[model samples]
Target: MWAKRYLSLDASRPAWAYALDAIIANHTTKSAKAARPRTKINVFLQDWNANTTTRSGLPVYARNLLNTAKKHNLSLGAIKMDKNLKRKLPLWYHLGADKHLKKLNNTTISDCLREKHGVTTIASLQRALRGEGGCDAPIYGQESVRDNCTCTTCQDLRGRGCKHPRRCRQAADRLLHFILPKWNPEDATPGDGLTLTRRRKRRNQDMLETSEGDFVFDPSVTEKGELSEAFRVFVEEDTTRHPPALRPARGRVVHQGKPPVQLKTSSTVFNALRAWKSAQEQMVSAQLAQDKSATLKKR
Candidate 1:
């Protein structure tokens, strides 16, 4: 890769442009499982002080090299300091190079040094320019390149699934939310300051809704009575029984609804129930009359 980029023309960039990247690729990297390596401040200055020649045999100063690396998303250690670091370091004597060139919020060159450094200490985390390609189709829009496939290869599949092994959602987000510049509309912008409004799942909705490009919110789910009917049962029957599971993991809000306002719609059953109620009332009134008569006779 270095040899190929070295031979490219003016617009294609020079070989010296990839020097920091080359240095980084050849060294051991920091990981979650490993201890952090300390890259002192002298290494970059050494190269800068020594006039390293370019591919054209002209002396390319390391100062210009650091600047070029910055343009390629590499942060210079001698300039920028991380806000999270504890001990303070002198200005222009920063520890490592940050491969990810995004400026941290409220951080500057004079702040405490963040321990993000390699053995040579000029580069840290590297951020890559996200491609505007998709896994399934160029039009599907939400997914990113699959299995590190090149942008051209990923966009080839005009149907379903990914051209590569994996489909990415972040690619779609990065592409859409990035603010486009007025000067060069074709140039892709990184999504830095933009905010994405997250799609929320409505309450009592038990359906599988996707947050894809074709998102639609249907409030009719609540009005359909599928949830309300399951939650509030008026009468106890085999149909109202919940699924059995273990000792007793019942639902928290499970309860019977109010009794039916008009029970037994059949006229014969309704009439018989009313007659039985009237007969009981008449018998109670007769018993009360007999007790009153006995008390008056005694008086």
Candidate 2:
């Protein structure tokens, strides 16, 4: 619960997702069938200083909440703010640095060129950075070795200033692939959920014109999740638009593998949880039966 407390917007998700991350994270972590006791979640919605224009100040809402809590055997309590926090609790462990906190200087640019583009020398860097249609403009940025070659492609590329004219479109393609900024999962703004992603070359790319490298090495980061979420929203929306299309959604069985842990350990944990739940239910039923008998006797 403590690890999940800060799942609310921290620093990793897009601004468009305000607290959806937290909401989804909570839903997912609890969805797993487990018998462990979980901390009860309470909505503390006392707008101490609510807007004056709102109907019936805020006390009425509090009273309504108390009535609802009582009806459901829920505890309703309030805590007063003792002191101001210097910084937000969630931001204390926010992912990625603030944009203004760090600036890219020549060092960073050079490092990025060297590591990602394999430009060892300043000369190669200038040629590599020529971008799109300059001399020797092949964006084989993923090459591990950086030796010059006289292959037909390389020579044909060098001989002609810009290769697009002589069908040296690969050069143009290199620029086309990287011209648009790639989506870094690290840049996922923390918006209230447990965010995670892995890096793969040529994974996050989009281009105005089609090209060879215009494919995502991984789609789970953006495509699968985005499309799945969009699909869910589409289905969840009011069917007033197309009420006839509504029907019970059939569920699909994905995978049925055991947890990726030692089989013995997993079995032990499962058995313990099962036993605990059995005992808990038994005790509750016995207590209820005894209470009922006592009430009958009293009557």
Candidate 3:
């Protein structure tokens, strides 16, 4: 019965429209799980795909809506009513919803979709499916071979480097990647930034090595000074490049029953590595201190 109505939908309606209609039908029929918005969306996508020749995967479309709604505390009803979001949401749902939705309010999917489809619209979607090539279709507008576009909106997007919102929230991560010097975590530190990269077990080669990536530090955890010091250590390790003047003194480390080890005077690679480790530890400590103070204030 639902399939017949779905098939009867005017071919001109947008993809999201089809999704919305199916959801409403389920509610009217008192379908099990219709009370839960997420479940309704999931069931609607499933029924739509099974009945239609062109099937959008159930998981893909469901994830796109659920994850985005989660970030903004949006009800599924709100998304259905917002035409601007309706325009953006389908493309995100169609191509790369899961990747972009992992981060709260991430727009990587939307921006990249624009980069590929050149500002999608309902008409564009129909044209593309029919091989008519809408908006950014090569026969229509233009394509960006260089990952950029010439339109005013795209020009602004490119100028901002097309970085997603998640990148901006990652301070310690950016610091580890050597993209910036100062990162101030907005909240308590999560943990040490070091990641175990390689573990080698050979004759007397028991040493375990670690490395750092953007995920190593949660930006919500550190302060600006700590991030700067970590980035500074990254610059210091490059002996081929001249060292910046007035380097910070390396703290001493003492192993069980072993004499103290001085970080700065150690082998060039080891010196930088130790400095980075020290900075990571300090940043974590600073984060903990901040969290404690905030807790006290609340009390």
At residue 3, what lDDT does model 1 achieve? Answer: 25
Task: Write the number of the candidate with greater TM-score, choosing between 1 and 2.
Answer: 1
| lDDT (tens digit, per residue) of candidate 1 on 143-239 | 5333555555344421233433232223222322231121112223222222223443342132344433443453221111111121221333221
Give candidate 2 misplaced runs (Cα > 4 Å): 1-185, 189-265
Clashing pairs in 3: 185-222, 187-220
Measured with C-alpha atoms, the lDDT of residue 227 in candidate 1 is: 14
- What TM-score goes with each of the models? 0.18, 0.18, 0.19
**Pairing residues by index, what is the TM-score of model 2?**
0.18
Considering summed lDDT, which 10 consecutive residues are worst modelled in model 1? 118-127
Order of models, best TM-score first = 3, 1, 2
lDDT of all predictions: 0.31, 0.30, 0.33
lDDT of 3: 0.33
Q: How much does each candidate deviate from the true structure in C-alpha RMSD?
A: 27.1, 28.8, 25.6
